[model samples]
Target: MMEKIWQRKTDETIGKPILEVFPELLDQKYPELLNDVLSKGITIRENESIAYIQQKEKLEKFYLDYQYTPLFEKNGTVNGIMITVYDVTNKVEARKKVEVAEQRTRLAIEIAEIATWDLDFLTDNIIYSENLPQIFGQEKGSVITRQKIKRQIHKDDLPVLKKAFGLALQTGIYKYECRIIKPDAEVCWIRVHGKLFFDENKNITKMLGTVLDITDEKNSHQTLMKSEEKFRLLADSMPQHIWTSDPLGNLNYFNKSVYKYTGLFIDDLKEQGWIQIVHPDDQKENINSWMEAVKTGNDFLFEHRFRRYDGEYRWQLSLAIAQKDEYGNIQMWVGTSTDIQDQKNFTDKLEREVSERTAQLELKNRDLINMNIELQSFAYISSHDLQEPLRKIQTFASRLSDLDEQNISAKAKTYLGRIEVSAKRMQTLIQDLLTYSRTNSAERVFVKANLDEIAEEVHSDFYERIEEKKLLSIFTL
Candidate 1:
């Protein structure tokens, strides 16, 4: 009410003509008051306001509901005018704030990609926001209907939306996700959430809902699932017994080879159950080493026997490596057991055969050495024994020849000469035998010997026979 009163400081000349009193109010803002009333001498009424500056150097704005009433004399003609103003600034400011908040709400909805809709179930009509058509790939603010919205939904998802809405009357709320084909034929996923508004009679009156574009979130989840499936398929297809466990070494998965080799099912292999297939002698060592590797995030290697499906233990080379994320945190442990039984058996057999053959060859070598020594001894004795008999024959032949040649006949002389020659030949054979023995038993030293010296020695030894037989002369060249 205090703001409704026009101040005297601003209206000091209020009793004067309108234009002369408030020169700031041009004909544009107070048009009828200045022209129609003052010139035509008639009543004018309107709802308009003006701003005026007062004594406080502060701007004061006003909204007034004013009327101009004409005053006349006893005659029928008008003579004067009366004007009134009432302030309505508070109403104007309150309405302006409401408009500003509405504009903000609209902008926020667009930024969040939320499409709002109101469905009047009684009329079977749906009213959508201005941007709803654009969300469905149509021009903005285009006319749309319930049937048209249903047609935009993917055929496969139509029944799902129908079912959800059918129950909404009883539930008072409905929420669902489905795919829709836009007007341009591009597919997208959307999430709808709404609640039913009920009348006082507890009957459904309308429904309000918001739609959100969830295409990116849906695609990302699908891609992750596909990657996991592919990894499982590859692991199961391997020939070696492949397995994986959590970072703490708690086993979680095993490939098909593991089940086939161990005669165990997946349910039986949870946690530490895989240890049952390890040979009793190796179980403790295997478990301890595996735990150590997991604790340190290091590669693990061990060789141990494992029981197979047919109840036989075979040597297996077990290897494990830590699989880590980009941050270097261990995500899991991957391990494999490769069959090495055949190679192990072959190497052991080869070693045993090599050892046996070495022993046999050593014994044969000793026997050959002893036999060589005995043969050398016999050669030396034979050469010495033969020389003595030949020398005795030569001695007897020489003595008989020395007997008087006049008493001996010619035939006796020829027989005695033949005996002497045979004795000389025997002595030469013995000398050669001794030389052969020396070469075998003694270490021979090579020395340069003169050929002329050796020939002279042979000639001196046979000089008597050469002279008697009148043989060719021996030259010592």
Candidate 2:
């Protein structure tokens, strides 16, 4: 073994001096150690001692376990040194690599603010990482034990941790999130994860675990909870029945108005659905519309009847819109149901009244048409039948006027002349009446009129009456 380590033949080293066989030892502690063993007649041993040896004409490093003992002469004087050596390079190098890896792991844990611990049941002691003390707000290098860790836990959380430990004994797994109080009395959240080890007798022998500070995460969660609570309170105060659903169309939240209107609790709605409150006839359409809106992520609008708590079904106009995220993905559905029973009743009443009024107007319009036709016939008859007799009177008076003056008396002539003038005026009045009636039946065309002619005609028609009343002077102009 020595020859192989020295890269030389056994015969070359067996009787040779130690320095001659291994010239590199002259610069190392091996020579001095050998000298001391010989002079003092003592022995020296070393394990895993580093040495540089010449191999293949090049210096190489090695780890060795070696011993040096003095060989004594019968007179009790040290004569020589006996040496023993064994190579331990592989074992030592493996240990060094393991130590380096362990150091790196410790550094990573510290940077991530994690504490690792190991508990030995037999020793009733805990071995923890360097950062464990700091996690509990203690000075560096402070000794940590299971009892010390337990004391740091919040009083309310101690029982929880105990329960977790008890379960771990049976399950071989430990997991819990709990609150802890630091030495400064600051409360914080932590998550612990561990695994249990058991001996052959099924007794827990050791436990290894890691702890993480989760205070920031817990604080953020709490803030979100408070905000949601505020939203719920505001929703409850509204008069409209409001509700919300998950992205999958699962109804999850309902406002106070919904419960008051439907007279159903949340648990009751959960077992079935809000559709229970829909009027029986509207249920099918309501379900279809809602499902379509959810599938397409579109707004929903439907007018349906909702059964009230008092057993009366009232009309409701329901509208729902999808709440979307930045990516345009549906996050939730917000919906409202507004009571429109009164408005619906008003609309129906107004339609009925309008229909009745329309029927009455049609009847009145027919009567007006019949009355206009009768008036037109009366005007035609008055123009033809009445004017014919007046024409005969004027012709007869003309014939009489043509007779010799001696044949008719002056009184008879005057009367004949008055009769003829009256007949002519009556005929003119009848003709004017016919013209006015004809114009009324169509679009009337207005024209400039001679006021003098109209006045003369009026004077002729009333002249006799005016003369008899002795008021003829009124028409002198």
Candidate 3:
């Protein structure tokens, strides 16, 4: 380190020969070290004075690497070094921070289309985001309160929503939907999805979220529902008849057209009362058969008579169907009937007219009728015609046996018994054929016959045969 030497404008440099004995004089100038002038120059920084200012940080001394003459007092000149030494580290660091903050603001605006805000809840004062005022519809830059926001919500949806800030204060998070009143008085739905700001103890300070207008989506849903309702209403008012029934073939729906054809309305009919118009004789059988099919989920292909509006009964062919669900429940049924009276009349008339077309046709067909008659006729003919020959043969064989009793062997008797057995077997086959051909021919008319009783009669016949054969036919069912 070296001491600084100050020089006045008019002072001269110290001589080296006197400065050698007292080396401190090397820092002096003029007479008596010219201390007064130099002291004044050092304190006041005069343009006519010179100062050796060491370039060092804090208390350290330094050498000047570069210097130039500096202008001092007015009308005066000073020859000295103007040192240029500066520590610029703090300045550069401060400039860097300013640049980074500017970049962050630019990026945030570009990415999110958002700005910042501050609010004072108790004072009801609001400091908006930079973009907020430009984007607001009717309430730009207005001081907002909890009440003001609540009033903007749609009247219909108002009952469900709470003040966002109040809810945020009580709860840790805030989420909801609301509508806003636009500048043009148009109602707009905005979805606000966000988080609530909190302090260390989880006390909410403010709420923040993103807002989106969703008016288009809500409008679409309402339009679709209205279209669906129109379709359903049109179907209900249609004139074409649509009906469904239970498995028992009950009348579940009688459309307006059906009511117009039949004089009776749906409520006027008792369960299956439509059967009453069936040509009385066909009613029982037609109803019973159709119902039997319904119980088993089978097709109901039946023809019946329906009473028309003109007080006449017309034959109708009804086609019915059933629908079953995954659990096999009869989910639904469908039925429709078509007029078939003309076809039925034509068929009946033709059958009567062609009953006796040929005598040969009658003979072959009549032989297929009446099993009991066929059996009696066979017995009557065989007893008179075949019995004589059979008896004569048996008598002759017996007479021959007696004559050969002393001359014939036992083999001869066995051969005679075999001949009798063969004759009996042929008689049984002829009786069986006649019975099978005539079964059910006598009762050919189709009716609602008592099937259970008919089955019982067949059972009785089997029992009688079993008793005669001494066989017990045990039944488990």
TM agreement with the true structure for every prediction: 0.49, 0.63, 0.28
Candidate with best TM-score = 2
Arranged by lDDT with the best first, the candidates are: 2, 1, 3
* Rank list by TM-score: 2, 1, 3
Error of 3 at 182 (Å): 16
lDDT of 2 by residue, 44-138 (tens): 99899999998986898899999888888999999987788899998999999999999998888878889999989889899888887877788
Error of 1 at 260 (Å): 2.3
Off by over 4 Å in 1: 1-150, 162-175, 191-214, 217-237, 361-477
lDDT of 3 by residue, 1-477 (tens): 123322112223343343443344355342232343333333222222322331332222222222232435564544332443333334555776888998887687546655444444335455555454333354555555445555667787765455664675676555566777755677876666556666787655565554545677678877889985664465346654345576556666654556777777666666557666567878888878877877888877777777787889888887778878898777666776777889999999888778766666787668755655766687667555765666676677676667756687787876666555445544555565545444567845556888777666456546647768987555414
TM-score of 3: 0.28
lDDT leader: 2
Candidates in order have lDDT scores of 0.80, 0.88, 0.58
Worst-scoring 10-residue span by lDDT in model 2: 437-446
- In model 1, where is the ten-residue run with the lowest total lDDT? 1-10
Q: Give the clash count for each candidate.
A: 0, 0, 1
Model 2: residue 218 alpha-carbon error in angstroms: 3.1
Residue-level lDDT tens digits of model 1 in 1-477: 323343444456546665564455553456445456766777777675655634345546776677888777786567776767667778878887999998898899889989999999899888888877777777876888888878888989988888887887678788888998986778989899999999999888888988888888899989988987887798888888888889999988888988998888877776459888999999999999998999999998999998998999999999999999999999998888899999999989989989998888888888877766675677667767887887788888788888898978777887787778767867777776666655743566677999988687677657768889988865723
Query: What are the runs in model 3 whose C-alpha is more than 4 Å off?
Result: 1-242, 246-250, 270-273, 276-280, 326-328, 359-477
